[model samples]
Target: MAKLDLRGVRKSYGTVEVIKGIDLTVDHGEFCVFVGPSGCGKSTLLRMIAGLESITGGEVAIGEEVVNAIPAADRGLAMVFQSYALYPHMTVRQNLSFGLENIQTPKPQIREKVEAVAKMLQIDMLLDRRPKDLSGGQRQRVAIGRAVVREPNIFLFDEPLSNLDAELRVDMRGEIAALHKRLGNTMVYVTHDQVEAMTMADKIAVLRLGELEQFGRPLDLFNNPANLFVAGFIGSPKMNFLQGRTDADDRNRLILDTGDTIDLPEGRFTQAPGQTVTLGLRPTELQPDPDGALHAHVGAVEQLGSESYLYGTFQNETPVTVHNPGQTTIRPGDKVALTAKSTAMHLFDTETGLTLRG
Candidate 1:
């Protein structure tokens, strides 16, 4: 196992920079995930760590050794890609042992390693099958097995489960998480899926454009986002935003565009009266109340067995969503009042898109 570190890491295509200065560290045996939207430089950052991309300026170290000049082959890291880059002609066992053979490993050691990895990944029965004959999930396991036999200091995965079906993806996620526990090797994964990052990572690095937005544990980013972008991007179904202004009569009160007023403790906000701000509320935070602060005109309902999600608009036509546990009888065109505790609310500055702590 090894620790991975990046300091002022950067990359650029001529004048257009893709990765601005980024500094992060992945502790030994830690599962670190780089998560962001498409074209957000997550993959580019991963490649730089893998030594597949040249670093424009900065340092990348593995186990206290700076490897900015090291070749990918000599970096002592194995990578599993989204494409399941398996040799079609080789059988599963052969594919797993091919890398060992290239380095002239003893035949007996190669066989032993292949057998162990195959069994560990539960792909022992498919050893004789070719990539063309294996299912997508099976092929992915084989690709991962190929990397495992290498016994590298670090493991890097680039959207390795994106190709699988929804059911298979969930199954593979568990398998991968188990594999991490068993091997206890430092792993760095890059994906656009927030769910994967939230579920698998010991720590998540949220990226946007070319900058690192926030880096912390999943729940930390979820409960207390540093900026508006992190708050909106971290949660599923996303957090809802309402435009409002500080009340002239009371600085601690905010008046929503819909004419609803929310009272806060004295000196809760530093913003003066009439200053525009945004109130962020998660779907789960909003509940149906007879005298709720906000009223919604339901537009759609999504029933998912154990839970239901209501999509609607406020009196000012501002869109909102509410997550209701279990079955919901609420239907389209129904008017409902929603309320949330002030403790569950998040406030942001309208001009800077930054969180307002006080």
Candidate 2:
């Protein structure tokens, strides 16, 4: 296993800069995920690490060796693509063994490696089947097996599970996680799905518009985002933001545009009074109460058996969502009051979008 490192890494096309200067490191045996929206440069960054894209500036290193000028094949890394890029004419075993054969590995060695990977991926039975005869999930397993047979220093996955159906995706996720446990190699994964990043990554790198927004443990980004963008992007239902201005009389109070007032804990506001700020509250943090600080008019309700999500607009018509336990009797057009503890609130400077802490 090898640790991957990027120092001032950048990629540009003429005047269009896709990847600004970035510095990151992936420790040996670590499962790191790059997650962001489309065109956020997560894929571009992965390609740069794979040596498939030329770096405009800076160093890409594997372990202690710089590999910015090294060819992809010589980088000693294995990649699993989003598309199951299996040769249609080759059987599963053949596809898995083809790479090894290209390197002129001995026939017996190739067979042993293929058998081991096939069994580990639970695709041993499908070895004789061609890609045309295999299911989507099976084809994906074959693609991963192809990578595993390489025994590279690091494994890179570029949205490998994006093509499968929801159920299949979930199953493959478990399988991939299990594979990582069994083979303990450094892994770098890129995906647009925050859910996948949250569930699969030992650490998550959140990106936006070619810039690294935040990189840390999943729960760190979830509970304590560095900025408004990170806070708004990491959670499932997404954190709700309310426009408000700091109260002049009390530094620990904010007056919302909806005409409601939310009390913050003593000495919570570091920004000056009268400064516009945003109050962020996660869906699960808000609770229904008779006498609550905020009020909303429910517009829609989504019941998913175990929990229900209430979607609505606040008094100011700003969209808000609330998570309720089990089923809720609340219906569309129902006006409800919601309350949350001051400790659960997140304050951000409206202008800079940076968190404002006490």
Candidate 3:
């Protein structure tokens, strides 16, 4: 296995700078995922590690070796792409063995390696099938098998599951996780799917607009996002933002626009009184209460078998969502009173879009 490191990595195409300077580290035998929206320089960053793209400035190291000068073939890493990129005419077995053959591997060793990988991937029966004869999932497995045959120090996957149907994608996700557990090789996977990154990665690196937004464990980013962008980006059904101004009601309370006041400990907002700020509330954080802090008219409801999400407008003209049990009786246009659990509440500055921490 290898440890991959990037130090102030920057990429520019002529006058246009696509990837701003980025610094990241992937420990040996670790599975790190890079995720962000399109044009966020995610794929460009991956290609730089693969030596498919040249670095404008900075260093990429694999296992203590600086690979900025190394050729792609000598990088000691294997890549699986979005497309299967397999040989159309060659059978699965031949495709897996092709790489070893090019490196002049002995015939007996090549046969053993191909058989072992095919068996491990549970594709032993499909070894004789050509690319056209294989299912999408099978073709993906073959692409991965080709990488396995090389036995490289690191594995790189670029949206390898994007082509599959939802069911197939879930199935292959488990398969990839199992593969990683079995091989224990260093892996760097890039995908726009936050679900994939959250589920598959030991650590996730979130990117936005050519910059690294946040890098941490999935739950860490979910619980305490660094900035407002991450606070809104990392969660499902998104957090609700309520426009409100803070004011001193008594010795220790910050009043909201709707006359709802949050009791605070001493010195909570010493410098920002009467400041316009946003109250960040997650759908899961809102609870049903008879004497709740906010009142709203439910506009719509979504039932997801185990839970329900309520879309509504607050009295202060702020849109909000509340998540509750699947058996909730709340319906569209129903009036409801809800309370915000302060422990689950987030506060952000209106001007900078940054979270306010006590």
Candidate 4:
């Protein structure tokens, strides 16, 4: 396996730039995920690394060698695409061995590789079946097995599990994570689903509108988001935002437009009084309090057997979503009071959307 590096990488077409300067590195044997919303240029950036898309500027290096001009075939990387892209007429075994055959691998070596990959992916029994005869998950495993047979320097997965059903996607997510643990190869995966990125990656690069918003460990991005965009994107239930401004009478407090006050840690917030700041609270961080600062009229309550979530509006306008552990008696149209732990609060500059807490 090798390290993957991107130094000020860029892509453009006719005066329009899709990928703004991106400088990132995926260390050897690490699972790195690129996650963002659609139209975020994540797939475009992955294609550039695969040498399928041209770089408008900067460098792409595999290990120590610059591979900007290297063809995809010579880059020693294996890519499993979103589409199965399997040959309809070929059996699973044939699909698994084709890449090695093209590269003139010995017949015995090819057979060994195909057999091992098939067993490793748990598709050994389906080797004789054609693509049309296999299930979606099986077809995907065949595609992944094809990549595994080659033992490339890096593995690139472009939403490889996107086509599977919800249940199977979860199963395959664990399978791929186990595959990485066993092989220990450098892998770069791209997905629009933050859940997938959080569950499967050792490191995550969150992107937006062709630019990298932040890159770090999953929990780091979750706990210490650099800005509003990231704070809202990385969590499952999504963080809540309350419109507020610095206290005119005191720099260490925020006065929400909802007519509530939040005490801030001294030396943590330096914004001038009256400057607009946003308070972010994750749904999970909220708790029931009889005289809590948050006052909301519950609009909807979802009980999923294990837990419940309350949807409501704070002070008649600002929407709030609260996650509660276990089952709850909270019902729609009921008045509820909530409070947030001091550490749960995330403050951001409303103008620039940058985080205000140091």
Alpha-carbon lDDT, every model: 0.92, 0.92, 0.87, 0.93
> Which tens-of-lDDT digit does each residue in 39-110 have in candidate 3?
899999999999999999999999889999899999998999999999998999999999999999999999
Off by over 4 Å in 2: none
- Candidate RMSDs in Å, in order, are 1.4, 1.0, 2.2, 1.0
User: Model 3, 41: alpha-carbon shift in Å?
Assistant: 0.8
> Best-fitting candidate, measured by lDDT?
4
lDDT of 2 by residue, 88-187 (tens): 9989989999999999999999999999999999999999999999999999999999999999999999999999999999999989888999999999
Q: Estimate the lDDT of model 1.
A: 0.92
Q: 1-358, model 1: which lDDT tens digit per residue?
A: 4999999999999999999999999999999999999999999999999999999999999998999999999999999999999999999999999999999999999999999999999999999999999999999999999999999999999999999999999999999999999999999999999999999999999999989999999999999898899999999989999989988877678899977887755554467777888888999999989898788899999999899999999889999989999989999989999887777788889999888866
Better of 2 and 4 by lDDT: 4
For residue 140, give model 1's deviation from the true position in Å: 0.5
Candidate 3 RMSD to the correct structure: 2.2
After superposition, candidate 1 runs with Cα above 4 Å error? 265-272
Give the clash count for model 1.
0
| Pairs with steric clashes in candidate 3 | none
Candidate 4 has its poorest 10 consecutive residues by lDDT at 262-271
Candidate with better TM-score, 2 vs 3: 2
Superposed by TM-score, candidate 3 places the C-alpha of residue 49 at a distance from the truth, in angstroms, of 0.6
Score every model by TM-score. Answer: 0.97, 0.98, 0.93, 0.98
